[model samples]
Structures are given as structure tokens and as C-alpha cells.
Target: MAGLYVYSVLVVLLLTCGAVMATKENDQIIKENNCETKMGLPCFLEAFTSIFETGSISNKCYVELVVLGKVCRSALVKRTLENPLFKDLRPATIIAKSIQTWNNCLALIDSPSPSA
Candidate 1:
């Protein structure tokens, strides 16, 4: 019984440590890359919704997201998935959505605009 209890405690501690390290890494990436300033709060929320839920992002917001870059976008999504509020969400599905959204925005930005 004591061994089982110790084992459970160790598991919890390892999980907690892993979460903290992931959070710290995400924060470091956000700070070092000036991710927050890259996109407005409204656009950030739009992008989040677009990736995590069945919401659409505006063209303006798409531009903002594209400018935010893959590293910042990926880290933000990973960090959000770590939140307790998002505990029920599947990380793999959400991550795939994030990548799709980023790719779409990148394509939109990279392609030449149609002539007037």
C-alpha cells in the first residue's frame, strides 16, 4: 500500500513538472519572438476560435495570423491545449487544425492577388 501511494505521488509530480516545463517553453517562445504584439487580441481570439472550434477567421485576421509565424502559432496552440478549460479537447485534432489554418493563411498571403 505504501509503495503504491509513493508511486502515485511520483507520477503526479512528474506530470506536474512536465506541464510546468511545457508552459515555460511556450512562454519563452512567445516572449523571444514578440508573438503577442504580432497580432491584436481580437485577431488572436479569431485565430484561436478558427483552429479550436468551428469558427471562421476574417481575411484581416488571416493576415495577422500569417505574420505571427508558425513557431508562435504552434506554441500558442500547444499552450492553450494545456489549459484545464481545454482539458476535454483532443490535442492531435486541435494541432492538425492549427496547422491547416496556418497553411491556409500562408497560402493566402503568398499567392498573388487577382488583378482589379
Candidate 2:
């Protein structure tokens, strides 16, 4: 019984440490990419929900997301997937969708505007 308790505590400690390390890494990525400042709160939430849930991103938010850049976008998705709340989600499916979203946004940004 005591051994089981110790094992449980160790497991908790390990999980906490891993989460902290991941958060720090995420912070560094965010800072380097200027993610927080580049994407406003509303747009960030829109992009996040669009990725993790069945939702669509608005063109305005898409612009913000594309400007936020692929590195920041990928890192944010990876960080969210690591959260316990997303444990049931299939990482590969979500990751594929993320890439698709990025590609779509990039295409929109790259396309020439209609001649006025």
C-alpha cells in the first residue's frame, strides 16, 4: 500500500515536470515568433477553436493566423494537443488539419487581388 502511494506520487511529479517543461518551450516559441502580439485575443481564440474543433476561420482571422507564421501556428497546436483536455483527440488528424488550414491561409494570402 505504501509502495503504491509512493509510485502514484512519483507519477504525478513526473507529469507535472513534463508539463512545466513543455510550457516553457511553448513560451520561448511564442516569444520568438511574436505570436501573442501579432494575433489578437479574438483571432487567437478563433484560430484555436478552428483547429481543435469543428469550426471555420474568418478571412480576417485567417490573415492574422497566416501573419502569425507557420512556426508559431504549429507550436500552438502542438501545445494544445499536449493538454489533458485534448487527450481523446487523434494527434495525426488534428496535425493534418492544422497543415491544411495553414496551406489554405497561405494560398489566400498569396493569391493576387481582383483587378478593381
Candidate 3:
């Protein structure tokens, strides 16, 4: 439906904004705050890695991500859910969209090759 398209576009914009504004300083802040006190860095990375690998979140991973959202305030999980476009969607649905967006975004990155 037309509503779905608009909603997807909004998700794309929000994800793009989050990715664009990210910098080394922001990464350090996120690590210092969320990784240590709120959530583990490996947990965060694994959630993302699983999303891309599975094309859908596992039940355990979903629970972990929800808990991460609850305990951490500075990360995308909170803001992504708060966006007007996501207000009507279920938490799982929002996460699915975000994961899909993340997969797309990561595809845009050019990985560095090992030096010979």
C-alpha cells in the first residue's frame, strides 16, 4: 500500500541521517557510555551481524536488542522507535526495518583489502 512506501522512505531517511552524522568522536562516546555501562560491544555487533546474516532476527537476538533498547538511551534503538513513522509499528517491525536499512547501508561501504 501507499502507506507502507512512505513509512519505508522515512525509515531510510532516519537511518541515513544516523549514519551520516556518525564520526570517530561519536563512536567513542557510544562505546564509553553504552558499551560499558549499558550494553556490551559484542552484543551490539552480534545483533547487527546476525541481522545481515539471517535476513531476520532470531528470537534470542530480538530479546537482546529489546533489552539493549531498554537499558541504553543514546543509541538508535530509542530514537528509531520514537520516530513518528514508527509510532504505529510494533517494536519487532521497527527493528526489522532498521536491520534491513542497516544491511543496505553497510553494502555501500567499501571494505579495505589486506595489504600484500
How does candidate 3 fare on TM-score? 0.31
Candidate number of the best lDDT? 1
TM-scores, in order shown? 0.88, 0.75, 0.31
At residue 36, candidate 1 shows an lDDT of 81
lDDT of 1 by residue, 65-90 (tens): 98898999988998899899999999
- After TM-score superposition, the amount by which residue 110's alpha carbon in candidate 1 deviates from its true location, in angstroms, is 1.7
Best by TM-score: 1
> Cα deviation of 16 in candidate 1 (Å)?
1.6
**Worst-scoring 10-residue span by lDDT in model 1:** 101-110
lDDT of each: 0.93, 0.88, 0.54
Task: Give the local distance difference test score of model 1.
Answer: 0.93
Runs in model 2 lying further than 4 Å from the true structure: 1-23
Clashes (backbone N, CA, C under 3 Å), per candidate, total 0, 0, 0
In model 1, which regions exceed 4 Å deviation? none
- Position 19, candidate 3: lDDT: 58
